[model samples]
Target chain A: MTTSREIRLKSRPVGVPTADNFELASVELPPPGDGEIQVKNLYMSVDPYMRGRMTDRKSYVPPFELGKALQGGAVGEVTASNDPDFKVGDIVSSMFGWREAYNANPRALAAAGPMGGIMKLSTHGMPPQAFLGVAGMPGMTAYAGLLRVAALKEGDIVFVSAAAGAVGSVVCQIAKIKGHTVIGSAGGPEKVAFLKEIGVDHVIDYKATPDVTAELAKVAPKGIDVYFENVGGVHLEAALNAARPFGRFALCGMISQYNETGRPTGPANIIQAVGKSLRLEGFIVSNHYDLFPAFVRDMADWINSGKLTWKETVVEGVDRAPEAFIKLFSGENLGKMLVKL
Target chain B: MTTSREIRLKSRPVGVPTADNFELASVELPPPGDGEIQVKNLYMSVDPYMRGRMTDRKSYVPPFELGKALQGGAVGEVTASNDPDFKVGDIVSSMFGWREAYNANPRALAAAGPMGGIMKLSTHGMPPQAFLGVAGMPGMTAYAGLLRVAALKEGDIVFVSAAAGAVGSVVCQIAKIKGHTVIGSAGGPEKVAFLKEIGVDHVIDYKATPDVTAELAKVAPKGIDVYFENVGGVHLEAALNAARPFGRFALCGMISQYNETGRPTGPANIIQAVGKSLRLEGFIVSNHYDLFPAFVRDMADWINSGKLTWKETVVEGVDRAPEAFIKLFSGENLGKMLVKL
Candidate 1:
């Protein structure tokens, strides 16, 4: 038997979660059964969607049960394999996150599923941790959202909220590469600088601007054609006002109001969609995972050519995973927030 | 010179429009110019969407400017003609309404463009008044919103708000015709009775039900698969609660919110879309006019076979057009409301 340290959901969170909501424990793992493998985690992803699982609501993904080990995206090395398919040294990614070690059935591993948000880590001349950040879900989200949902047109002006964050960063970069003018909004000077360095035509430091909608209108005078929605609330309202007639919104997440106690008031200007014929659609990365092959291949080529760049805010240890997740709400971390085990 | 009485926007209304907001005027009309024909108005439409045009705001259709004739869908006869293509006694429809008579260029009558929304009236064994309701924009809205936008599957459990209204009534009947069970909600006992007569599986008298969401939950225990949103605000909140995962919302209009002084707090539970992976798309019938030929054929067949039936609330004379349009917000008009000139 092997002992592994793991974090589990202690209780359902009411609004904002605290350390008391998660319980750390030791679990004794039995030998890997037939067609099963044991993995020693190298890096784990702490994402916004994980916050939804902490609550007892019926969402696209199941809520984390009390006293049970929590799961998400994790990249690890195979330590022990009963099946010949999964060798001891093969690098793999699974939905069995929040743990230092895990035993999983090889059958549950695929490119897209509840257990396999993505299965094998396509190294693609990148670091193993890259599978949890830029080269993985966040990266694919931006690719599919822009190309498929927003329907990026040539010479189109695009606006992205949370431009310094994981998904937003990639979205802004891809829009620029596709010959579309890009406008990005971030919370601070460093993030704004990062956006500028990445070739964004215009950047808005939302922290410095009192009226984001007015500022967006000023910069995107011709009006935004595409808006990648990461943060909701004020961002949606701003997008609504800035977007021209027939603009498309690729809505992936709404991190801003995930922890609200009462019902979150949506954009006051949602009615604008009716007037402008704006198409606002919410999507999960799982729905577009079929594009993974093309995404990974294109992303690898882009990285090698120095056309794509990324950042990771790593929190060292499985014990600090909860803290890393909380930091996502406070906007403390830059780029993709990850936990290095 | 010919004289015509017309209704025009006096000033933008603060909240609910009153008689004071509209001006009754008589205009002197010149003879029909080259390529133009004179039309004697017979049946004019007073639709809920016309309320949106009353506001001095940019929309899919231009606002009804102050001190001008308010234009909408009107079917009339060519009393006088200068164009060779148009002959005397030819029945036609144009974007001329809220008046007794007018002279318009024949180019404005087409199947599809800015001028295309106003088509040459096609009465297929149905009354000319039928062209204003069941065989016109309202009917096409119901057909396209279901078959295209909402993507209604064979067994979809449809929930339509304002189900006794023009578009909603057609939406409910179409859902039933496609082998789906339906629940419809409308104000007062008369509208509810009308819905039941039209083969709705269940009907809710919304006026009597204080908690619409709770009432919806009771009727649609299995949950709704498609929501045709004609009324926004409380109805939208109820639909959000009743909708199942992956449900689609065809947001054609929001009549409940057309007359608000301040911002109307939209569906408080709109974030439910994110969780349910629900898709909400607002649309105008003009965008899908290609479906008109198919729509008219199928609708005429349905009406002839008695598989479909319709009702219209007629407020006679062009003088009462404003009062007829106001009836939409008050929910006084049951089926397609019209003004007989």
Candidate 2:
């Protein structure tokens, strides 16, 4: 028998999540039987989108149930395998995260679905944890939203909110590699420096700036053609104000509104959309997994050429996973926030 | 020489415009010069979009110049012609509205551009005044916005605001003719009855309805697939509230917020766009005139089949044109509002 430690939802959160909402529990597992594989998780990811799952409301994905182990992206090595497709010591990624180890049927893991599905990673000279960060769902999100959803064109100026986050960092690099001028907005001097390090043409430290709209106007005098929205509210209003005619905004995530208890006020200048002929479209990365092959190929090339890079704020051990998640809402993480199991 | 009475912008409006913002003047016109046509306008249009032009700000179209005649859609009879393309008694439409008569080079009238450009009408048993309303810019707006901008599909239910107005009434009929259930919102008993007369599946008298969002939900229990947005503020918030996944909104205008002195509050639930994966696209009718051929042909067939109808509120003389325009904000017009000279 093998014993594993896991975190389960003790109670749903009212506003911002607290460590008390999660409880550490341990379970004993018998030897893998039938088509099951045993995995020992090495690393797991915490993202802003998971906040929606905690709420008991109908959305694109189902809400997380109380008294159940929470799920997310995780990389692990197969400790044992009864399935012929995977052998012992093979590294794999799965949605069975927030836990230290588990035994699962291969078919069930595969059925975790897009962005949450299981996959075997070759690593290709990179760390297995890279699958939970840059080379994974967050990476694919940046690629699809900018290239496909926003329909980025030559000479189009790109603006990204939350520019120091996992998805936004990749978006910044992709726009640079494609030879377009990029503008990014983030909080604090550290994130501002990181944005500049990634070759962002213009950077706005929203923490220091009193009015983001005026700051954006001063930087993008000619106006932006594409807006990659990660933070909503004021950022959205600023984008609307600075957008040129026929501008396109890819609504990926709105982390700013994720923790709000009440309905938040939206952009007051949204009416500018009509006068300027803007298009704002919301999308989930899972919906565009059809571009996986192209995304993987392009990311591999960029990584090999040293054109793509990422940063992470890691917390050690499974017991601290909830704290890492809470840090995300506070802007305490510089880039991707991960828990090392 | 012939005398013409014209209305000019006397002052820019601070908020909601009053009669003092406009002025009436007389101008003398000589016989038609070379390549020129002299026209006596029979009917002039008073539309909601003109509100934008009255403000001194950059928009899709240039703002109306102060101390000059305000321009809009008008149908007139040619009194004299120096060009072979037109003859006396031939009916023509031009953008030189707010004036009873004018002599202009045919090329200048043709260069009025897109929705404001000049066109000689065949009439084809329809009244010449139809060129300024049902058969002109407003009809084209409803056509392109619904079919192309919103990309209406079969079995998709539609919700339209300002369903008793010029462009919106056409949108209602088109949805009905295409065999889709349509829910429309208008003010007053007369406007509500007009919506039913045009075969709208559900009609909400917004003046009597205290909660538009709740009323919309009661009528469209399955949620709306396509939203034709004309009235903004409350209607926009309600549409965002009841939108199903992948719903599309074609934003044509926002008459509700146009006269506001300060920044008005936007939809508090705009963040719902991200969760529902909705698309909101704003458009100007002039941008889609390439669909004019299809729109004109389809409109003719619909009219001949007796499946299409319209209403107009007319005020005699150019002196009352400003009053007619102001009545639009109060929801006093059932459908198209016009001024006769």
Candidate 3:
């Protein structure tokens, strides 16, 4: 028998989640059952949407239960396997909980689920951690949400919020590849610089900028055609005012309002959507699972051709998973926030 | 030379248009030239969109010139024609100004402009006035806006505001014909009764029911799947709250804000759209002109089969056009508001 370290939800959070909401414990790992794989967890993702799951309200996906291991997308090495499909030493990404080690049913680790939880990584010329960051769910989200939902066309101007985060980073790159002029908003100078390095046409440090709409107007004088919405509230309002007639907004997440005590105030200029004849659609990456194979092929091709780039902020220990998750809300992570056990 | 009575824009108004903002002038009609047709106007349409054209600001279409005749969809008789395609006594519709009579280039009066503003009427099996109402722009708006833009599917629950108005009246009928459960909101008890008589599955009188959201909740407990938006502001807010996850909203018009003093206060709960992954799209019926042939066929079939019904509130004499136009803002007209010359 071996000890496995795990982080479980101690209590539901009211506003932003804290360390008090999580309890770390060490439990004895049981032997792998038939058609199961015992894996040593290597990395776990700490995403902004995890904050929504900590609450007790009904949402697109279910809320996390108290005293249960918090589940997220994780990449690990299989130490033991009773299933023929997976073997010892085989590295795979799975919907494994936040833990140091665990035995998972092979059936549960099949492919991407309905809520867009997990998927196996294609071992091309990319880092294994990329599976948890840009080349994984976040990458697929930016691709499908911007291309399929927003119907981004060549020469269109794009504005991405939370610009240097996992999803936004990929969104900027994808927009550039599609021959669109891209402007992004980040919270700090370093992230803004990173965005510039990745070929973003323009970057704005939202923290230092007093007026977002004015800044956006200066960068995109012709007006934005596509707005990849990740941060809501003020960012949404700015995008709305800066958008041209017949603009399209692809809403993937609302990180700013995820942990609010009550309903967060939306953009004040939403009426502009009507006058401009705008198209605004909200979507989840999981809803497009049917297109995963196609996404993987295209993304891998971009990576191999030196057109795609990715970054990850890795936290070392499983015991520190809660802290890493909390850092996502504070905008501390530059790109994807992950825990390496 | 014949004297033509015309209504011209005197100045741009701040809020509700007044008599002082318009000038009724008696001008001499120009003689028809080669390829020109002299139109003796018989009827003129007064629509909510005319308010937008009254402003100097650019919109979907250009703003109406301050000193020029206010153009609208009008049906008239060809008193004289120098064009090979037209003849005397031939009734036709064109984007003619608010005038008793005028001479226009036949090329300018060809089929219809970009937004399908005018079309020759077929006065078969219907009243001649029906060509300006149900078989005209409002009817096509309902058909294309609901079916093409909203992508209405069978069994979907639809909610429409300003249900007794021209566009909304047709929208409910189209949704019903597609096998959808249709609910509508009108201003008074009389309008509510009219909505029910036209085969709307449910009706809510917004005046008697102070809480529109709660009223919608009682009828659409599963929440609305599609919202055909006509009245904006508070009504838009109610629809946003009552919309289900992945719901679609087609924003065709916003009559509520047309006469507002400034930027009207919009829906307070728009953040719900992000959480529910809803899709809200604003479109002009003219954008889907390629689908008009199909729309005319479908509408004609429904009308002839007794599956579709229509109503009109006709105000006689072209002099009453301004009064009829003002009544749209007050929600005083049921179905289409037309003025006969």
Model 3, position A192: C-alpha lDDT score: 86
Best by DockQ: 2
Clashing pairs in 3: none
Over A104-211, each residue of candidate 2 has an lDDT whose tens digit, in order, gives 887765676545555889999998998887899999999999999899999999999999999999999999999999999999999999999999999999999999
Sorting all predicted structures by DockQ, with the top scorer first, yields 2, 1, 3
lDDT of 1: 0.85
- Candidate-wise lDDT, in order: 0.85, 0.91, 0.83
lDDT for each residue of candidate 3 in A218-262, tens digit (9 for 90 to 100): 898889999999998788888988888889999988788887786
- Where's the lowest-lDDT run of ten residues in candidate 3 chain B? B111-120
Model 1 chain B lDDT-worst window of ten: B110-119
| Candidate No. with top TM-score | 2
Question: At residue A258, what lDDT does model 1 achieve?
Answer: 86
| Model 1 residue A54 distance off true place after TM-score fit, in angstroms | 0.9
| Model 1 regions more than 4 Å off | A30-35, A108-114, B28-35, B107-122
Error of 1 at A97 (Å): 1.6
Docking tier of model 2: it is high
Per-residue alpha-carbon lDDT of model 3 for B168-197, expressed as tens digits?
A: 999999888878899999998778888998
What lDDT does model 2 reach?
A: 0.91
Question: Which of 1 and 2 is the better model by TM-score?
Answer: 2
